[model samples]
Target: MSFKGEQHPGVQAPTPDSQGFRLNHTMLRIKDPEKALAFYTRVFGMQVMRRLDFDEMGFSLYFLAKLDENEQVPEEQGERTVWTFRQRGLLELTHNWGTETQADFAYHDGNAEPQGFGHICFSVPDLEAAEAWFDANEVEFVKRSDQGKMKDVVFVKDVDGYWIEVVQADRLSALGD
Candidate 1:
């Protein structure tokens, strides 16, 4: 099907490719790695699949994933690196050295005047329960599930002010063909 603004005669719909490709991960620059890591792990129940520190480059890459209940992360660096790449829906947090020390340091969360990148999303089993948990934990909310036009949808801000969309997984399944 053609999308809006793609009515040009020369433009053709994209055909599915047979390549064995998949979305690896999405990276977000974080001012404070410690705080960001805690927020993601404690609030979202994500674990650190792998951590690569580039001391020479003055930065670090942290790969996090929400693993299955029985899944265990590899202890070896090599094994962890390989395993991290194989997982889907991973979140990469990049931390530049010394940024955490600066009192006035902050990253562009892409929600200001010149907005570019929007937000990342998470599907939970229960929207109301998740919303209550967030509220109890004192997490900042940009928009609640019952707010505005979008019912049963939530938008929360991370420590770095990045927006995260939360929705009910059951609701998603209901909308699927």
Candidate 2:
């Protein structure tokens, strides 16, 4: 699969296919880029791998990752500080200058109505341990369960109310095979 003249990763060049296109990042507008970055880094244990500035647009983008989930960082201060990008998954935190506001969406607080889009999902190896962490940390979990062959799933909200889905990767496989 390819698209827009960009060759698909496993397909021949010079032509794009729609099926080859994949998600690069999920962009979210935040009230404070610095605060959001810190929250994600400290809570999820993700590190800022790269940042790009759009001076003309007055916005900035950041890339983050888990310490051991990717390749070794060239110069990390400690074991837990060596986050890297193992795959294409990324969170794009954008800050628009002088807005002091966040767009109404899954990341924002807009009553109990989910507004269609509601959460970002992450896979963890252990359901019990992850749920315990959320409970001990006082994070509000929307749901939790072990669905037999489907995999154990848990949902939690961060400090700013962004919902996160934690599940076993095996759950995704069960749906197909």
User: How many backbone clashes does every candidate have?
Assistant: 0, 5
* Candidate 2 TM-score, C-alpha based: 0.63
Cα lDDT of model 1 by residue, 21-134, tens digit: 778999999999999999999999998888899989999999999888998777889988998898789999999999999999998888897998899999999999999999
TM-score (all chains, Cα) for each model: 0.87, 0.63
- Residue 54 lDDT in candidate 1: 93
Best TM-score among the predictions, by candidate number:
1
Worst lDDT 10-window in candidate 1: 1-10
Question: How would you encode candidate 2's per-residue C-alpha lDDT over 81-163 as one tens digit per residue?
Answer: 22323345778677777654545433454335666556787878877877787777676777775644334667777656677
> What residue runs in model 2 are displaced by over 4 Å at the alpha carbon?
1-20, 67-87, 99-114, 146-151, 171-177
RMSD of each: 4.2, 7.5
Backbone clash tally (model 1)? 0
> lDDT per prediction?
0.90, 0.66
